[model samples]
Target: MSDSILFNVIPYAAALVTLAGGIARLTAKEPAAPPSPWTPAGRTVLAGASIVLFLHLVGLAAPRAMQVFNASPARLFTLESLGLIGALLLSWGLLTLGLRRAREGQWGAAVAFALVLSQVLTGVYVAVALRWASAWYLHVTVPYLRSLMSFQPDATLLQAAPLVIQVHVLASIALLGAAPFLRFGRVPARTPASVEPGLLATPREETP
Candidate 1:
């Protein structure tokens, strides 16, 4: 396969693995006092998500590099935007896992999850907004500003598209991060509360 195809496929596979593992854990029978922080299910999802997230970062950075090397503006914008969306979603998934762990009283694990999640969310927004601004700088705003350089422009209108994009990206990331945690972390401990005599009683045969 081509390098480009491999690059895209890797992240997708990682995401699928993470999602599958997470779903499995959610459906599995709850253990008393929550599963170990390093349980098989937890580790699988965490590792998968981390791999996917790293791939996403690489994907986002590539477009910026292409732009620096004089790649087509349209293609740059499209690639960057898609990368931003992917990164946002990955970060969101991570944060959600952290929140869920916290709710289950796994504070340390939750904190670690949250730290990475928050960083990814913040970075994705900032990077996407900057990328959008760069697009406007090369496309519309810079040209307009140059035209008005001689005349005193009454008011300046900067592109709000980038800011809006940033907000939406951040929101999306946060939501995705919160989803799994909310779904799985809320599961109560699966302790055997009480043993009833009836449950243990053997069936008795009736005599005529």
Candidate 2:
């Protein structure tokens, strides 16, 4: 019962919240302002996050291909190494962002940063502790996520996974649920090559 609630029920609930909140955010009227610029840390975070998200999506989209890709020992190690590097980069950016937010007295945003950082840390731990993450992810996480997408939630795929992995998955879902409500401030426009690093501060205006 508990497993069903946690894996099956919670994911759907979070998805609903994310869907509704996203629509509301899109439909709301707000004055447009000049796009702010991305800070160095923000760029770092975006780059790292994009890499990690891309890999995950690729795996989910082509589990069979990923399995074949990981069949070689060298290839598997290389893939895992890239994942760890991305995680490290993400951690570095989050640490910078969180500290800046704290210094600015944006406690809410800082707290959100902490939650996200924890999620990232847990993923790093999973990658390190559970060898061959990409291979196993295809077996466990991908199927489960696909199940959720197909409206056939199967908690069993995760029931046997390590507790940390389970926590990481659930925490990610929680973040998705809370995404719309998190007012972390507007992301600045893309930093141009000519922009001085010193001038690339986050926008002062917080998004409602």
Best by TM-score: 2
User: What residue pairs are clashing in model 1?
Assistant: 92-173, 92-176, 92-177, 93-177, 96-177, 96-178
CA RMSD of each candidate after superposition: 16.2, 10.0
**Model 2 stretches astray by more than 4 angstroms:** 186-208
Question: Can you list the residue pairs that collide in candidate 2?
Answer: 36-188, 36-189
- How well is each residue in 1-208 modelled by candidate 2, as lDDT tens digits? 5888999999999989999999999999978778677889988899889888988999999989989888899998899989888988998999899888888788888888888899999989888888777866789899999999999988787889889878988999999999988867554455557966658688688789
**Would you list the C-alpha lDDT of every candidate in the order shown?**
0.51, 0.87
